[model samples]
Target: MKYDFGEAIDRCKTNSLKYDFIEERGYPADILPLWVADMDFKIPHETAVAIKKSAEHGIYGYTEPKDSYYRALSGWFEKHFDYPIRQEWVLKTPGVVFALSLAVRAFTKEGDAVLIQRPVYHPFSHVVLNNDRKLINNPLVLKDGKYCIDFDDFEKKIVENNIRLFIFCSPHNPVGRVWTTEELTKIAEICIKHHCIVVSDEIHCDFVLSGHKHRILSSLSQEIADNTILCTAPSKTFNLAGLQAANIVITNPELRKQMYKELTRTGYSQLNSVGLAACQSSYEYGEGWLSQLKEYLGENLKYIRHFLAEHLPQVKLIEPEGTYLLWLDFRETGIEPSELDEFMKHKAKLWLNSGEIFGKEGLGFQRLNIACPRTYLEQAMIRLKTAIDSLL
Candidate 1:
């Protein structure tokens, strides 16, 4: 492979949230962190070079992306997802979460309801509550070893709560279930019928595993496109979260206007210069690197499956369909939900995201990020096995 995912680059003292602040986050200083969504792999060579080029220019003035940047960004979506994006439909933001917060304020008023699927990315809840909006959850049901959305409850909640906005996670975080075309269509239909604006966060759209496809939610129909705010970024794709750049697509003129108004209210504009260069470069030249990274991640997934089956069968792998995050069910281990975090930190000496933070439905489960080197995963598995074995 042209890209080496096996090399473990030291992230310590880099002020990395995942590596540098373990102790500050209440985990042991020595604990191995597999919690955050970012990868441990180096970004594509072209992306790094572009960033260095931008930095070497000396003056870090306020910068905006050129038409070429938009071409590259649009070209990526058209090539990968077959979704054509009008350059004017794109809005730049620091991150997807920031876009979600902006959408909440733009589309809904205080005390107005916004719907989200539970056991999802925690920020979906935070964005609503933080903005004084009503939070309504349509919890995804686990059926026959897979997570499925309850469409009836989804529509019911929107109608009952008078929800005007829906924050959606495609190829959802934590559980790692990529929404099928049929599923996305259903969601789009429900939101349209209810006249609710959909903010589809597709940051993990590029990280899908084998045998699954991620459809852009708005690409289904003209009507769906009119009502959807599609949030996307290269942060997860190229492991450039620290750079903080995201492209938010809003096709509807009125919705875009409102979002622009909210963005103006925040007094924020133009992505960081380095982030702009990295994003444009990655979208243009990082495909080969991303392809190899996915293959390596697929192998890492297999390793976890085999290791767990052979050494820690009590823990059930939820079987991720997309993203590098694995949702592991430890219910069979007889670990109480309240004590699970302590067990992972103290016993396993491994830092993972406790499922409860996603929502009540996430209890008894843990979100493990496998976007690191195979050796890191092997060590994490051994740590987990030893921790579980101690109970016996």
Candidate 2:
């Protein structure tokens, strides 16, 4: 492999939020930090070289994204997703989190409702409420250990709440289902009918593991594309979240105008210089590295599935179709959410995301980020098995 995903890079002294803040976050100091979505792998050498080239210039002046930046991004989207996006449709932002917040402001009024599918990335709920908009949750239905959209409840919420916007997570976080083309089309159709401005956060789009293909929400229909704010970044895919580069693609003239206006009003027009360089370099040259990383992650997912089946029969992996995150159901273990948290913290000495934080529906589940070296994953699985054995 051209890039090393197995090498254990020490992150302790780097002041990484995932690594350096475990004590502050009330977790054991020695606990493996898999709660945050960031990976432990080194940034691809090509990306590192690009950042070094920029740093050698020694001028940290305010900067804007160059034409090359746009080309790199547009080319990547086109190549990977087969979705042709115009450069004019692209708008840069510091992060996808910012993009979601900005979309909340741009599309909805102060009191209008924004609907989100629960057991989603936690930030989606906060983005709506933080902007003084009402958060209407249409929780997904989990049947036979697979999660699917509850279309009945979704339509019901839209009608009852008069939802003005829908924040959709494609290649969804935690549960990790890559919505199929039919699913995307149906979701788009529902949003179009209700006149909901759809904000499709596709940050995890590039992280879809083997056998799962991503369907870009905008590619479903022109009507959907026009109404959709498609957000993506190299952050999750390339492990460059600290660099904070993300984009929002709006094909519709009016929607684009509104987002641009809101962005300008907030003085967020300029791109993060380091972020832009990382984004451009990663999209253009990190393909080989990403390919290997996905292959390695596929192994990790397989190990997890087999490990759970062999050792912890009560806990089930909700078969991740995409994303490095694994959603594990502990409901059969009959552990209360609070008891599970204590066991995970003290007994397992692991810091995984408690599913309840995603939503109340997340109870009886925990999210495990598998984007780490094999040795660490082995240790995690062993510790988890020990903890569960003690509980039983």
Candidate 3:
């Protein structure tokens, strides 16, 4: 089936955080928003039908996933990445961040140091700090326009801080470099040697661009698998964030038990019926839609690259290898890191995730979600070019 990637959809007044809450979020009412991670596209047709069917059943009571759910979930990982999943290893959660918070409480005590790579998804830091754990950052280094991990610093930070828990963003958020196998191996070896538990967020695993591949951290080896907690969900892939379903894969029995106990302590159980229905059906039947979406996104990426070079030369696009979010560097425009937000909001009349929110390393940078129609990007680029022109 041919999907309409350019279809127009009105999201305003739908209680959308990205659309309706602009004024509440301290941005001008008329500013176009491309900040939040959710896509502007609609969910796949199969997923919608499954959700509608479940919703019409009338009993929206607490629910647990059956064997069919496990088959569909495991089937996806096996089919796409050649990573097999065991039924017992799966633990359903409300979302990945929620599961991360539970992992923080499960794996480490208060004041224990937890490590993360900076300029990552902000919620990583939040899960650590809000849980009363000490936060340690090993910031990624930008080498020749691509982000790379400083392995020495990563290991040193773990030893110096006595870190036991590390949150890793795979195919990384914001600055989108998919980790090669060599990179994944070194990380796994260091974490294993240091006895640091790795909570690997592979939420964007399915969105790798052409010429790159996403490797599951735990799939490296049995030793690494024992020390890893893999976080995944169909929310980002299928545009079902509102449904609130995530799968936390833990190969280590003890670690799985610990996290599940912490989850139970919070009195949270059973994913919503509609979310379960949507997730299973999407994984089972939405592959055709996803394939076409990736192709559309690839074109959007090309358009941005050409648009920036031709018109907005001052803005540097940090070439992305995965995910729809593009990290844009505005430092060349001579805009002070502190003033970039104001400039984007008031001058450009646009709403994007300020780089500083990710970390100090993100200063003078902005994360733009490009999972919308090409027309949206066209309008955003015009507004940005006009804004930059006014500065001169």
Candidate 4:
């Protein structure tokens, strides 16, 4: 591979929220972090080169995304995902989280209920609750070691609460099940029937593992697309979260105008020029690098699964359909969430996200970000095995 996934880049001295700020985040500084969902690998070379060129220009200025940028992004979707997106539908935001918050504010009022599938991303809950909206959890059911949507429960809750908005995580986080096309259709139908707006966060769409394809919820149909506010970004796939370039696509003009007005009201207009360059470079010329990165991540997942099977048999890995995140079921260990948190931090000398934060349903689980070099994961597994063995 031209890019080395095995190479461990030193992120400790950098202002890396994942690594450097561990102490600030209340985790022990000595613990190896596997909690945050960003890659340890350097971004694709062309993206770096593009950002560097922009930096070399010396005048940091406010910017709007160029047609070339939109073309690159749209063209990428067309070539890679077989989905064609128009430039008019695209709204620029610094990050998907912000995009979600914008969507929440745009579509709903204070006291309106926003629905989400729990044991999912923690921020979905945050964005809803923080914005003064009522949060409704439709927890994903863990059956036979994989997560599945409870369709009846989902529609029932929406009807019961009269939910005003739904925040959908595609290629869901924590419990890494990629929602099937049929599943997305049902979700869309339910939202349309209920007159609830859908915010589909497709940030992790590009990181799908082999044999599973990610279908943009908007691509389901024009009606579905019209009802959906799709949030996408190159951040997750290209290791550019800090760069914060999200492309929010909304098909309905009034919805687009509403979101744009909210964004303007919040005083967010121009995007960072370096981020723009990075995003354009990534979507335009980073496919080969992404291919290699995905291959590397695939092996990393396999390594972690095999490592657990051989060393920590009691801990079950929920086979991931997409996303580099792995949801490990450790309920059999019989440790409560707080105790397990302490064990991982103090005894194991490692940091992994406690599943409880995702929702109550994630209590006995651990969300492991496997987007790092294999050597890092192997070391983590060794520490984890030692810790679990001691407990057992």
Residue-level error in angstroms, candidate 2, position 15: 1.4
Pairwise TM-score winner, candidates 1 and 4 = 1
Which TM-score value belongs to model 3?
0.99
Pairwise lDDT winner, candidates 1 and 2: 1
lDDT of 1 at 17: 85
Q: By lDDT, who's the top model here?
A: 3
lDDT of 1 by residue, 253-354 (tens): 999999999999999989999999999999999999999999899999999999989888889999999999999999999889889999999899999999
Q: On residues 1-392, what C-alpha lDDT tens digit does candidate 3 reach at each position? A: 88999986999989898898877767787898899999989889999999899988998887889999999999999999988899999999999999999999999999999999989999999999999999999999998889999999999999999999999999799899899999999999999998999999999999998899998998889999999999999999999999999999999999999999999999999999999999999999999999999999999999999999999888999999999999999999988889999999999998999999999999999999999999999999999999999888
Candidates 1 and 3 compared by lDDT, better number? 3
* Candidate 1 all-Cα RMSD: 0.9
- Candidate 3 worst ten-residue window by lDDT: 21-30
Can you write out model 2's per-residue Cα lDDT over 91-210, one digit (the tens) per residue?
Answer: 988889899999999888999999999999999999988899999999999998799998888888998999878999999987999998888888888888988889999999988866
- Listed in order, each prediction's TM-score against the native is 0.99, 0.98, 0.99, 0.98
lDDT of 4 by residue, 328-359 (tens): 88878767765777888888888889888998
lDDT of model 2 at position 281: 97
Judged by whole-model lDDT over C-alpha atoms, candidate 2 comes out at: 0.88
Q: Model 2 clash pairs?
A: none
Output the better candidate (2/4) by lDDT: 4
Instruction: Name the lDDT value of residue 355 in candidate 1.
Output: 95
